[model samples]
Target: MTSDNKDRLGSKLHDVEAAREDQWARQRDADLLEKMRERMSKTACPHCKQFLVAKSEAGVPLHVCPAGHGAWIDAPALKAVLKEQK
Candidate 1:
């Protein structure tokens, strides 16, 4: 094949590869977003109106807003965490 034709073919191949990578990245991002949404709490934070993310600190389970609005911990759990701090 002529050098010019080979260069064009190589450019096309590069474009194809870039398109595939872009598609894979978009799919990956979508999957990650879905998983994150699934893990989020059904309840909304009263302070921020955002969904909460469940977490454990010092073995105490609590729901925290992703916006850093505030965390929801039951009275007993709060006592446990505070007691442990002392």
Candidate 2:
């Protein structure tokens, strides 16, 4: 093939890879939002009366009160947080 044709093919491949990466990232974000919504639907902060936001602390998914009331950490998450402190 000619050099020009090869360059065009390379550019097209790069564009396809970029588009794939963008789509993957968007899907990942959507999945995370859905998970957060599910968690929020099941629990709420007593002090603030608002849905808790999902946050990662010490590599654990912890439900955090947006109003700064506090956070809800599960048993494994609590253990991870405590271990990080020490």
Candidate 3:
């Protein structure tokens, strides 16, 4: 292949990778939202005095604060939420 063609292919590969990353991020965010919605009905966030959200992150509930106060998350127990915690 010509050098130009090789460059074009490389560029296209980069674009594809970037697009995939973006799509994955969107999917994760959406999943978090759905989890939050379910928790909102019965959960509460002690940090911002709002509701808590559930998630499948890893350590704890991937709760987030849409209002910007952060997330009120807990491990084996529930406690006062932190700041910029997400």
Tens digits of per-residue lDDT for model 1 on 1-86? 99999999999999999999999999997896566546557779988788888787777767898999888876777898889889
- lDDT tens readout by residue for model 2, 3-80: 999999999999999999999999998997687669665797998788888887766777889999998877765787
- TM-score on alpha carbons, each prediction: 0.46, 0.50, 0.48
TM-score for predicted model 2 compared with the true structure: 0.50
Q: How close is candidate 3 to the true structure, as a TM-score?
A: 0.48
Error of 2 at 59 (Å): 25
lDDT per residue (tens digit) for residues 9-86 in model 3: 999999999999999999998997676567664665556666654554554555665565666454432532333354
RMSD of each: 10.5, 4.8, 8.7
- Output the number of the TM-score-best candidate: 2
> Which structure is stronger by lDDT: 1 or 2?
2
Q: Could you tally the backbone clashes for each prediction?
A: 0, 0, 1
Best model per lDDT = 2
Measured with C-alpha atoms, the lDDT of residue 9 in candidate 1 is 100
Residue pairs whose backbone atoms clash in candidate 3: 45-50
